[model samples]
Target: MSKTNLPNESIETYLIRRRALMRLGAMAGLGAALPGLRAQAQAKPATPLQFVGWQYNPQIVAQNVETFEQLYDENVNYQLIPGEYAPITETMLVAGKKFDMMYSEEATLARWITAGWAQDVDSMPDVAAIKASMVPVGVRNLSLPNGKLGGLPYYAGYGSFIYNEKHLDQAKLQPPTSWAEFLEQARQLKKDKIVEFPYVSAWAHQAPSFSWSLFSIWYSEGAKVFDANFDPVFDDKFTSVLEMHRTLYRERLVSPDIFTLPQEGVPSYATGQHTFAVIHDYDQKVLNDPKLSQCAGQVRNAIMPGATRSTFSWVSMYLMGAGAADPDRAWNLLRFFGGKAKDGQYHVIKRWALQFGLGTPYTEVMNDPEVAASFKSWKDTDVALQQLQNSTPRDVGKTLWYQDWDWYMMGAVQDYIRGSQPTSALVADLHKQVGVFKARYAT
Candidate 1:
């Protein structure tokens, strides 16, 4: 028997036949749509990469982690860690433990690379991209003493003489061109009662694993701790640098407690207690925090008065890490963090992140019309750019070379000068303490 004959017999059968054909057409339409849906389903998740760093704020890391995770493939999990910068350094020092990304200052980088804690970064395919992304002063200096790119570039800030700009303007004085001019200006500012105190520079704690900021001022003074062959030559310039601090201290520009300020007198400076301060180019943004500073934008940056160098500067340098299981994927994360991409996501993320005070590192991003225009609202963008172009590298070994001798020296400087404690006495005290590290571990 033919089943078709039976199906056509009923009153409802005629309607069913028409409905079946319509269902077939719908099936065909779905088939047409299936290819794109299949492609979407089959697409690979972005490879998982780990980025570990010292997020200065916990809340920031939490918010950005969600965004970063969403930006990558759903299968890719991104974790952001917030902690001290030094721990990240120590983590990198651990052999064979992979960190997809990390950051450090130039001096710490020198030590890590010197001690074989860091891998050769030239092996990365994104070296060219890093070069393109980073500023000249920030990354190119990596090849100086070590002959390897130690770290990727991050934000580079100027080491300027910070001051109450109103005071300088009121006194009809321009920013000084040299230390002599700095002292002379200090005296004038003091005499004019424009500043309650002369000038003091107090850096944050064992910061950046070193005192490269002070090195910047010393380099500006045309001083070096080592000769061309890298022999230790701590002599006249070292004493001169020491004496300059003493001169400022003696002049009462620096408070008695300035030598050991934990907040580096940011609290005092923000309160308008000082006429001048020596601080990083970024200090303006930091000190201007509404909760911390009353003076706010009144404090501004000027070129650090030095001997010869344009501006000896220290800055944070970030690098793509070795031992990443996915080097290419890791580079993508770095590129994203470095802020070089033209994509809207990058622009939005960087602008937002910078609001938390971590400045963008890339030229394309920093100079992006949108980002640049916004930055100009705060300061003379052109002048800041010009100053950035005018940076000098800190020596990695010897004098201004790697790590925290200057910080140790800065700490000891107070007792040595004020209490009539000799340099030999300070050195003797340090000899029993830090000298062992210098000799045992000095690279």
Candidate 2:
């Protein structure tokens, strides 16, 4: 709900003018205090920069802001937008509102850039240095279709199977290597009373998460939704992907609460009740936190299992607003958050990765020997980074009509899970809808 200002006058302009007038009045009222006051007034003013992004750790945000203000003497007004950041940002941009910087994920970057809402950070002088410091996957994910950089990398996450090591050890099962193996493991765990519901699927009808869950299976089977020519290609492999989830549901291996769970699979896993979950790399941070997770320190990560070890990979980036009032200051703020500070210390992202086990796209941070030494499980982090090399070729939301496609896809998934439609019928409907979306929105 927090916004910068109305179209007539921005909050920054009004504050600057008001402060200047007040300073003049104070100087006029007390001439004797002018010498000390003059020195303070002459000091570089704090440039007010507005930033909007998904909700982050408040303590982390405060620490980053303090460090940035100390380094550059600028005030960053960070607003954490909760739930569905892309649509909220798109709406704000359509209304002609301006922000200094905003957060966008890889799936939405193409749409945001094409709509002229994002600035080309690649044009900045420091970009070459920054790019060199980042992981190659992060840089490639943030690149726009025209070969310009759409944003600066914040963090990168790859989908992986997170399991409780204790449960797996008790069941005498190694992590599953293929979809068939995964189902069998879950069934055996349930049969042996190792865990009541061994698998948790993120089936909440939402953009990105819902699509991401399906994509994990599709990608594992070496399937792609769209061809290079932008045509919808829903073959039998995709049908099998949907059927895989149906099989889990039919076997009662998946949680019934999946339909209504607001968040992703992390919550179910954290309860210490589930044996396996498909989750983002960042979820490891929460699962490892003693205060948040009952199974803390017992969770382990593996590359998602299938015919091939493939999973979804994504990056969230700090996108400079195209309509920024001060482009240099905006870029500086973005650089501070995304890269190192004036003291040559990495700022926000580094601390987050170290303290919470969140994945980082900075090679320096990941490669730091100290970082690997600090974790209870270094192999988990190492495996996730290694799997980043096998990420899906394209995010599903790259198309402009992604919202339309998402609606149809999510509904079909729900129908299949609830037994309202069979896998063959659902696949047929999905293919037909993709054709409709392609005709309407594909270029």
Candidate 3:
């Protein structure tokens, strides 16, 4: 069989054609189900498909599963793996467990593909449509080096500046348009006593939050931690990035409690204690919830400030296991989660985005009027799309040793933030550690 080619269209043209296709498919009684997938579903009785992923929301997952079962007549045994997702997934795959469908991130997917554990998603019948439906970041992450599709892009979380608009108003300040402007505003907020701490860091001593905070600054400044050869390339640009954070710590503009805060700086921003924060897309949703946040309706999302507006991009993907008992049924189920249904809706990813504030990579869903209307902040979706456009793929794509590299870097950053290590010493140590990791892990 030949490989499927996805349509490449501008945002406007894509939306127009997508809408037309939906109408045409519905009128012809075809529904939005992929052609070959719909036929396969009707030919067989429902069978149980084991699905695993990190926890999203229990109720939301249950609702989606229930809907999927009713629509396709398939039973889904969905499990939310506990503890760190990457390590847990690695253990399961290494142990040779059978999972028909698995939820994964781009980094984890890269490792799994290299280990020969992931099935090429391009073999699925709907590959063309799926590719065309997603944004560039999704396409780049899910497609492997040989041009084979590795996974179905589910949802993406991009970094952005989420701030308390009410606090900024009180201080007679606007959201900063550039990195220099951001520094100026931080100083102004402190001078005017707008908030005790104008900025908060989610620099927790762990995989996700630590890396998320570090990369938000690193990428926004247009710096790369690793070169094409996967060698650690520490330069003045990297030094400048670290020094920017050091300055914030020295000036007391950032919360000192960040060192011990396991919740990733949400408390500071949600309580209106800090006027500004760098946070993921979902963090924006959390801060907008009136029941969960003191700032609730007053929160707004802005593009990250820097010489070039760039931020870290994360993807949650759906992969077919290499050892699947039923590849056909597995493909059907995977399509159910990532593809549009008979009603022209992406039930799972759409609900996930609405319940949480994370962005879906599906172009149609992202631009849907109803979905846009559901966000508390009018600009949230727009800012998210903009960030995704300018995003750098999660660093794992650049190197398989991302987990090790991140561990060493996070430790050094923690020490530097706490004044246990100076900037010069931290830079030197980073170079040394990267060299060590490369020697150990590089093939």
TM-score of each: 0.74, 0.84, 0.84
Error of 1 at 287 (Å): 4.1
Kindly list the per-residue Cα lDDT of model 2 for residues 14-97, writing each as its tens digit: 223321222334322321222222233334554467776654453356467667766887666655544456776678788886
Better of 2 and 3 by lDDT: 2
Give the candidates in order of lDDT, highest first. Answer: 2, 3, 1
Cα deviation of 416, candidate 3, in Å: 1.9
For candidate 1, list the clashing residue pairs, or say none. Answer: 152-318, 198-253, 220-307, 221-307, 225-399, 396-401, 396-402
Return the lDDT, model 3, position 418: 69
lDDT of 1: 0.55
Model 3, 379-424: lDDT tens digits are 5666666777999875445356666768878888877866757677
Ranked by TM-score, the better of candidates 1 and 3 is: 3
lDDT of 2 at 228: 66
Off by over 4 Å in 3: 1-47, 342-344, 376-380
Q: Compute the lDDT of residue 227 as modeled in candidate 3.
A: 70
